[model samples]
Target: MNQVWLRVAQLEDADAIAQLVNRAFQVERFFIEGDRINPGAVRELLRKGKFLLAEQSGALAGCVYLEPHGDRCYLGLLSVDPGRQRSGLGTLLMGAAEEDCRAAGARGIDLQIVSLRTELPGYYRRLGYEENGTAPFPASAQPKQPCYFIRMSKELG
Candidate 1:
């Protein structure tokens, strides 16, 4: 594997980020019926938050979204190429997100995962996040099965 490089996403990266995000989120097809995001949505997100992209060999390997809200930062859309799922790219992106939040004077980070993805809580847990609460999944999503959001948080040192 080539050395993975990290950078802040730019508006011009919308299409690539959208494509990479959809490809990485294909696993959600079991529950969700469409792409996790489109370029337009990514563009909108860019206006509110920043995405940290991980590239390997000139291709996007992973990305994570970070949005600072005063003392807490919201983290989301953590995606890693399916082929690179266990390669530590996700962890690397997460660390980058945390560092960025910490640098911004955030006291903690918050994120949410689909409850149906039972494996996700543990993944975030390993990174020092704890289940803080839950939220109703959007009705518009029309998931194949019942699901909700599991909110998690990690306080920065």
Candidate 2:
């Protein structure tokens, strides 16, 4: 594996970030929309929060978006390159995101996973996140089937 490093994404990274996210989320093929994200959407997200990117040998490998809200930070759009999945990069990104939130003075970190992705809740649970509740899926998502968000949170000590 190449030397991996994390950094805050700049506006210039929107295109690469979108490509990486869309590729990683291609598993969402069951949804009404085939692609998980677009550069325009990524650009929009950049306006609201920061994106942490993981690069390997100068190639974008993974990323997660963080938006601070009062005592909590909302983490979302986590994506690892399809070729790099199962290599523990996701776990590293999760840890980094939590530490970033903690360093920002957040008391907790929050995230939402698509309810349809049955495997995700357990994954986050293993990372110390607990499901708090469910929220209606975003209208923009246009899910093909009934879908909602599984809200999860992890307290930072």
Candidate 3:
């Protein structure tokens, strides 16, 4: 496999990021309404956070969004191209996000996974994130049924 490169995303990457996210999240069809993200929403998020993109041979392979808040950073929309899933790209993106957050003075990182995605909590746990609590799903999420977000966090060393 070719080396995967990482870079900070610019506004121009919003569309490609949105498409990658939506494609990666198509599995949500079992639980949520609509796509994972749209270009306009990604643009809005870009204003408040930074996106780290993973590329292989100059093609977008995956991405994650990081938003700093006080002592912690919020990580979300972790997307890996369906073709690249399980190839360790997601893990690489996560490590890079944590490093960036720590460099920015954050002591921890937090993320919310939809409760219905039963496999996610365990996956995150293996990545060192602990289940902190649950919160109502964001209104913008448009869940297909009653759903909540399982809040998870990991402390940075």
Candidate 4:
């Protein structure tokens, strides 16, 4: 699909991104830290210059979060609009995020997906991510329900 590809994110994108995230995960929002997610935190996340949005015909098709993790970077909130799935947009965004990280000297890419989302881990594996086992949750990083998220990582080229 022909669309605008950019990493521009303003405070205004927060609500839209939140809505998209809410719809994408729904009952699985805990894994997303949705309970802890708000416009303010979204703004901070975006301010790090990692969050990105995909726009098609002036509307957002997907959103992603790429928070820096010391030498590595963390990929989270990889949500695509329900209507926009199966269009290769997610893969496109993932590539862009990975490329950006590589350019920034990240040794690897880290991710945390809910263990319950068995299909998602497999999906990441297909994209070259490998399971590194359950990662610890900082007492302040997120909520309690998604306590034992599976950690995955991919070494950058």
Candidate 5:
């Protein structure tokens, strides 16, 4: 991979980001995917200053949404374009999200990963994230998913 840059996700990137998010994780039978969030929602996130995008040479590569809550930030809807996977784009997005949280005075950043993705937890662990506990992916709140969830956290040091 070449040099990458982080920027605020714009509404215009919503379709591209939606395709990336759905294409990346929609195949898993353990969870029924949610409708790709509306571009308006992405715009709102941008307005609230909660979203970030990763790019290389002006191409959208990856993204993560951070919801600040006091000293902790909730990370959600993280994704990297399949065409750009295995190239450290995910790490770049995570790093940028953490920085965003820290800049907002967050003490820690956390995410909920589908517990059934056996390899996913290890991936986050390698990035210095730890399993904080297990949580339910409420079929109602979550997208009709059968998978359990695990909360993971990385301290902002």
Candidate 6:
């Protein structure tokens, strides 16, 4: 396995982050329309929380967003570079995000996956997260097929 350096993203990384996220989220194109996020959105999110990034050979390999909310943290956008998917980068990023949440005094982490992504729940479950509930898919997403969000959460030990 190659060494991957982890760090909190900076403002200048917005473009790269957006590109990486868009590429990683292309799998959702079957149901969702367009890119997952833009550089402006990435900058806005930077103000609310932090993006934990994984770099391999100084290139973005993966990223996960962590927004601490009271005693719980909202985790999202766990993106692993498509070319690097299944290389354990997603798991690596998730572990780092969970640790960051714990250090920030969060009791648990919450995340949601599109209902159309039938493979997600099992992947998250392997990381100790359980299905909590569901949320309506944003109308703005303009999904091609009917879908909702499957909310999942994990309590930090």
Give all candidates' CA lDDT scores: 0.94, 0.91, 0.93, 0.80, 0.78, 0.94
Q: Pick the candidate with the highest TM-score.
A: 6
Write one digit per residue (lDDT tens) for candidate 4, span 1-157: 8766666567888988877776766656545454436677787888775677888888888888888879999899988888888798888888888898999899999988766676798788888999888866566755545566798999997
What lDDT score is found at residue 150 in candidate 6? Answer: 95
Worst 10 residues of 3 by lDDT: 137-146
Name the regions of candidate 1 deviating beyond 4 angstroms. none
Candidate 5 residue lDDT tens string, 46-135:
665566888888877788888877778989888787788899889888888877788888999888887667888989999899998998
Residue-wise lDDT of candidate 2 within 3-101, one digit each (tens)? 789999999999999899889898887875777778888888999899999999889999999998988899999999999988988899999999899
Candidate 2 vs 6: which has more lDDT: 6
TM-score comparison, 1 vs 5, better candidate? 1
Question: Model 4, which residues run further than 4 Å from truth?
Answer: 27-36, 136-147
- Winner on lDDT between 2 and 3 is 3
Tens-place lDDT per residue, model 1, 54-84, is 9999988999999878889999999998888
Of models 4 and 5, which has the larger TM-score? 5
What is the Å distance of residue 23 in model 1 from its true position? 0.8
Which stretches in model 3 have alpha-carbon errors above 4 Å?
Answer: 139-142
Name the 10 consecutive residues with the lowest summed lDDT in model 4: 27-36
Residue 61 CA displacement from its true place in model 5, Å: 1.2
Model 6 deviation from native, Cα RMSD in Å: 0.7
Q: What is the TM-score of each candidate against the true structure?
A: 0.97, 0.94, 0.95, 0.83, 0.84, 0.98
Candidate 6 is scored at a TM of 0.98
